[model samples]
Target: MVRLKWRYRKRLRKKYGRLIWKVKNRKGRKGFFKSTVHRYPRRNYRILVANEYIAAHLAKSLGLPVARVIQAHVRGPRGRIKRGLISMQAKGGQVIPWKKAKKKLLKKPHKYVKQAKKLARLVAFDAWILNPDRSDRNLILHKKKSGKKYKWYGIDHGISLFGNPTKWNLRRAKKKFSCKKAYKFCLHSGDKKKQRIPRGLKRFTRDNRKQLGKMVKKIQAMPKGKLKKAIRRVPKGLLTKAEKKFIQKVLLCRHKHLKKALKRVSKHFA
Candidate 1:
């Protein structure tokens, strides 16, 4: 795979996207970032972009496992990385291709299933916290030391903070443990009596609930001025009255709630 030079074109990419290119790196091999997809006019593109940036930053601050964003530019103001622009590039880590994940995770239990559940529990907390736009495809499965474990890294937040207004609908994602591998895990395990729930999943979800609640509590614990100052660092335009109203409708506005937030987080304890 070779890197392609970025050119400022009036139109978006073609059937396969012009800016898109496959990149081979030391750790992972993936396609180059598509500069045009986000450029096309759509639903609150600027706000959505800013929201993605905000989500990534906020997730990192709260210590959630997320992808490291790389800001790239073909051309910019005075030829530097455009201040408000971001683009994806290949990075280290075995980012599992979604196409093959279901087959692998489902065809019996070819290992890595436990790790998948653990990763799901961890990321599910992220989903619960920000209630961000997440899908099975965004998760990456990779092997680990101490007997082939698995880890999940969150990706694609552009649709998160500013995507659909229905993100905070907690009940939308049913509590039924239905990860692709969950079924396989049950099938392959010796215990055929109903799908077995792993101890690790319970512990992982419990810890995630604790962590997010802690993060919310920490924010609530902070002095008002400091909290305001912190929120100010987020991109300005991303904060919209409609968005705020939507968040409030879903009850995820920026406010101080130590015990309440903790209770809210644990309520979805799966």
Candidate 2:
């Protein structure tokens, strides 16, 4: 009876724990979930896992810049819905009020863009090259009362391990890379066309890289247990192609490039 009860509790936790949304008091709110999805043979993943992974990643890096992932949740068609995990409520750093800024104040959002790009370079150098899914939806903009603003985030990461992995390439990666970390690498790298930046698409990619780097730096500095606990909650969902080796190769390639970047930027950061 004891053994069966333990097993039952575990199952219940897994079922409810995996869900992305929650409510405190009467305020309906969202929560972040970490997840991945397998291909057809394995069956698709519910949204719960995917969203949480993103929230954790973003929340991990608000120290630098990139909006914060306040809450992420996962629920299927059958689950109740509020707004969303990474939707409007997310917060980490503060963003200047763009819509409220005036002509002279035009600098806030544009400046926000520049800092966000700086954050993205960290992602590029670190080889976290899953670009498309690293969009504004998963990230938040933070502006402080001090008037000094920077990106502080990276909320979603589930989309990267999947097929094709967001139209990424070495050249764009190089541009996003830190000039301090990979100066020479940039020199040798071929000039690849910028990922086609539509009105909103380009900005999102640009900001994600900046935040990605910020997150990595923070994670590298954190205690092992904290990081492990944070990631442990990440569910083992299936990646898009389900070809783990391919994803591994991509990550490995990115690591090698990161080494080159570190060497290039040694003078600056060192």
lDDT of 2 by residue, 1-270 (tens): 111100000111122122232222123332243322223212324233333443345344434333334332333345432222332333333433233333432323445444545443434422333333443334444445564544344444433322122232334543554434332332212333122111242344443445545545544454544433444444554333223333334333444355344333333321
Note each model's CA RMSD in angstroms: 12.2, 11.7
Off by over 4 Å in 1: 1-44, 73-93, 97-132, 143-147, 164-270
As for candidate 1, its clashing pairs are: none
The candidate 2 region of ten consecutive residues with least summed lDDT is: 3-12
Runs of candidate 2 with Cα error greater than 4 angstroms are 1-42, 46-118, 122-127, 144-151, 163-233, 236-250, 258-270
Candidate 2 overall Cα lDDT vs. reference? 0.35
The candidate that wins on lDDT is 1
